[model samples]
Target: MKLADKHTPTKEVKYGKALGGFVVAVNISMLLCLVTENLFSYGAAFVSLVGTLALFFDVMITLQFILLVLEIWSRFSRLNAALQDALYPHCTELFVGASPSYRCSLLQLQKTYVALGRAADHLMSHFGLPMAFDIAFCICGATCSSYEVLVKLLSDSDVPGLSIGMPVSISEVWLALHWLRILLLSLSCAAVEDTAAATGVILIRASVVPQRRTAEFDEFLRFTLHGPRTSFSAAGFVKIDRRLIVSALTVVVTYLIILGQLTFK
Candidate 1:
């Protein structure tokens, strides 16, 4: 297809806009709250501005990454749709292996699938450094935010000056947003593999239900058997799957425990 004929999805664009607007509004609101609390002191104003800028940039990068993930997922979804459409007519038991055209079509689709898998891995590789930093940012931020929340709730101190510049409500939102972003990142990355698995299912269904044993399908099965290796990962060090979210939250919890012990002791 021509580049012009392929258009960006309108719904995704609207979603991107909504996310960007929300991030901007939240950052601005947080900064305003900080500035108000500090009585607009010059030093606090400078610090809030710097912090807001850094936060805004960080969230924007994450948002862009999410949008990219959604786009890739859409492509994989379209691949599934294409598979169904292309093979529906030829997917009968006795006729599937007899058609030369079916084999050709399957070969083409296998190429598309392989290309998408490699592209997803390459995209992950490209973002590896940023992902490591982003996860680290989330880990530290979540730890502090959770600590603030716990201090507000569990501590016996009634002093207003105990907060580390952030209100408990803001800390709650901060903690939720950080995890939500990371969770979305992990789920979206993992969806690529899930969608790829759906393709495998389509092929396997053909073989299982109709018994279409062909050379092309065997080749395709061979590739799918190795699909997990091509899944998105963090510079080949760690996978960007549901487990990553679990691991990240585990780290946050461990630190939260340590901080609680030290503070409460």
Candidate 2:
């Protein structure tokens, strides 16, 4: 099947765009707050303002890339759904005859799956580095921000400027946002992995059906099983799945603990 034949659902595209836009807007607001607070301080911190602006632009670019990644995953999922529908149509007897047309449909679905996997691989090749950077930045940002807040609380320092409250400071908010973004990214990648794996399972189940059991069906099944497995990884280092979020959180906590120790000393 041609690449143009597959189409992403309009609703999914719209939702992804809207969510990305909202995240970017919130991040911009946070960065603007930081900049404004710094500007109005005792001494004009032009250096800090430059850093804040750099962060602002960096976040904007990262969010835009994330939006693209999400759209690609969304389209992959939609293609997988279409493949599933092809394998199992509304009528139970759709594949009962095991005709040549049914076999062709299966082949087409397999081709589509391969195309989707290639698209995923292409995306990983191009965006994997940036995504790894995003994850590292989030982990470091969350850890450092949390550490600063903890140090402030422990020292009983004057809560001046943006660091006003004890429970909900600007740093805490920044940490929360970083963590949220990490969680969302992990979940989205895991979802794509799960969907692709499910496609294989569905094919296997379809091939085992008594009515659908045929040489052609078995051939298609073997072809699918032998093909490259679909998964999302970060710069070929680690696979992104549900466990990723937990592992990332563990790293963040460990770094925070180390930072705490160093600060206390």
TM per candidate comes to 0.78, 0.77
* lDDT tens digits, residue span 1-265, model 1: 1111132112243354565466457645654564454444345667767766677677777777766776667666666776676667665555435478767767777777777777777677678878778877877888988999988875447744344555566777777767877787788788767987888888767666454567887788777776554467666666789998889889999998999778756
Give candidates' CA RMSD values in order. Answer: 4.7, 4.4
| Tens-digit per-residue lDDT, 100-141, candidate 2 | 876676666666667777877887888788778888888888
Give the range where candidate 1 is weakest over 10 consecutive residues by summed lDDT: 1-10
Q: Show the colliding residue pairs in model 2.
A: none
Candidate 2 has its poorest 10 consecutive residues by lDDT at 159-168
**Residue pairs whose backbone atoms clash in candidate 1:** none
Candidate 1 regions with alpha-carbon error over 4 angstroms:
1-43, 92-100, 155-165, 209-211
Local distance difference test values of all predictions, in order? 0.69, 0.68
